[model samples]
Target: MSLFDKFEPLNAQYVRLEAIDANPFAITFDHVLSPTEAMIGDSRILLLGTNNYLGLTYDTEIVTKAVQATRAFGTGTTGSRIANGSYDGHKKLERALKDFYGRKHAMVFSTGYQANLGIISTLAGKNDHLLLDADSHASIYDGSRLGHAQVTRFRHNDPNDLHKRLRRLADVPGDKIVVVEGIYSMLGDTAPLREFAEVKREWGAYLIVDEAHSLGVLGETGRGLAEMQNVEPDVDFVVGTFSKSLGSVGGFCVSNLDDFDILRVACRPYMFTASLPPGVIAATMEALHQLRARPELRLRLIENARRLYAGLTGLGFCLGPEPSPVVSAIMPNPETAFALWSDLLKAGLYTNVSLPPATPNGLALLRSSVSAAHTPQQIDHAIALFEQTGRALGMVPASAATHASHHAAASPSLSVTSA
Candidate 1:
């Protein structure tokens, strides 16, 4: 049989799973939860790995708006945006985004992934060059390939590398799009926007910033990294999603381009895909408003992240820098990481497990997402669980080496100040 025809292991660590079944933390849940908790199969697990950065999923107002919209518009769109699905709901949501991002216009997509795919693939076509950060989202990679653009990769967050790459493209320019993210999804570090602004100034190429993880989590007004860095005016395009902080399931692109209107008709993904449903539209509008008006949500989220991050490090766990909404605990290898994952589940805490290929440099990760909804008590519980798991797995000794930052912690707590 061909390699493609062969069935692969669902989990490589199945042999050790006898331990999993015996775990007190192996769980199932069946109810709604706050920022730091979830009901899985039947157990209430602390949500240390949710992308619900703002905890807007459980907002009563958003739920009410979604329900109202469903009553008015029924269920699905039933057709693609180009055919018979373009509703007022789409335009309304787009307008709300435009005002929120301080842009003249915005275009919506089915998902953040598609937003990148449609915009990147459609704008930078054949004969173009795409200069992107190596750690950019997969959607960006796919879009660049689909665009058939000549791709050049710069080291993660390394502006000097970007400058060198741009220098090479100086002579040959059909069009070049410098792509980056407001916040990297994996390690949750932010891009150096000012350095990028300087590079683009010299290269004279357009810049696209993906704020899928940054929107509503950074910036004074929830406009994302561009706003936080005061580079919104410098960026050529800003793409983001309703999935993460937006508490919904749509995506958007905001640009000052008169060409943006053109992409609606020219872009195959936007044209062929069914438009967003009314409930998504209505709920998103509510979410965006809350994201802007309620800066407290952002502040609480940062505080929670800092607190959780710090607690993990203090416990001798190797973690990412500063408190980002995405806090990853990297393991030396996939086997060790999987072992840690199984152990964590046994302790009743669930997180994203990063293995090779998915994680660069053969590094595996136990990724946790901090949410504003996590109370001090919930965070403390999760940290205790981590320590327990680490000790049990031999990843750490009973007392550990005490050499690993004996007092490590997430960043300090945060508070959002309104404009």
Candidate 2:
């Protein structure tokens, strides 16, 4: 057989998507205008699929810091941190993260995926057990497989199921590490962290929470769900990314464990990969400072999310369980979801088309995330476009359109003073 024959099934699926003009996987942005808008080819489209929750991608301060760092440290590290990639800026960023999370130690990785891979694989080794949420991110699953531990998955957000699984392992002589996310990326639903923490405590298992989507979008101080749910003490490790709220590229793990520093040498992913560029580290630090100094950004983000959620629900689109920065609409099927996504793109709106394996429970999703930089008019315009597209696609009725328009008209002002 040919070397590429194994990808025949994937090729067939790609052709099917292209035939329907719904091949979102091949789409690309030519230029980014702002945090909430971008140019795809020659058309300017409103960006709704980005995870830039606080919308600091184009912030003046962040850009300035990045530029300064580039001039100071040259371009790339050109080597792994274990060799020559560890610089003053990298060490400084780790220290800042350690202070930010109030943890005893912090280790930064080149990418968010590596942070998960390095931490999870190193923590649960040969004789250990890893209990993961069924809806956990792909990185978590890959990390579990990289290690020699036996992995068990509990139902998504089901604390009772987690308890039962941990109980079954009561007789097993090994360390148990329970992994969960602060906010699920697909459905925008948050995990019952308080309950999960309780269960982990009762079962004597260490808890690791991935706050990739919740950081800068939850908690009074923007710590994460653990802080929002008041269970920080129950959590043993916190894994997060600078790519999301921080508007940069990197990942980190913070823990109060006394020997957490050992991971610097033990984690293969971290030791083998080159570190982040100096510019990225600088920009991420600045963004973190901005996130802490400006709490109103989080408020504005939630307000925008609530507005969009209300508008879409009023137009009869099935949405996630609640209003969050990450909002997704479930479609009847993959074809319908693809058609809707293509329609939205044609209407100058850009969103994510998530299909099975990537989405939860085989559900197709038209995912749109709200950014703090999204203006009120931009959000309202997006709602109007969704209504028009939904009606044209028979996803929403004409009667629902009237109600949606009325709801949008009667909506309160979205003005919130920045700090």
Pick by lDDT: which candidate is best? 2
Q: In model 2, which residue pairs have backbone atoms overlapping below 3 Å?
A: none
Top candidate when judged by TM-score against the true structure: 2
**CA lDDT of 395 in candidate 1?**
68
Residue 241, candidate 1: alpha-carbon lDDT: 92
The C-alpha stretches of model 1 lying farther than 4 A from their native spots are 6-32, 400-419
lDDT for each residue of candidate 2 in 1-419, tens digit (9 for 90 to 100): 99989999989989999898778999889999999999988899999999999999999999999999999998889989887748999889989988888888999998899899889999998999999999999999999999989999999999999999999999999999999998899988888888999899998999999999988988878888888888998999999999999999989999999988988889999999889999999999999999989998998898888878888888889988877887899999988989999999999999998888988889999999999999878888898899899999999988775433534432222212211
Lowest summed lDDT over 10 consecutive residues: which window, candidate 2?
410-419
TM-score of 1: 0.91
After the best TM-score superposition of candidate 1, give how far the Cα of residue 276 lies from its true spot, in angstroms. Answer: 1.1
lDDT of 2 at 175: 98
Query: What TM-score does structure 2 among the candidates reach?
Result: 0.96
Q: In angstroms, give how far residue 171 of model 1 lies from its true place.
A: 0.8
Stretches > 4 Å off in candidate 2: 401-419
Output the lDDT of residue 142, model 1: 90
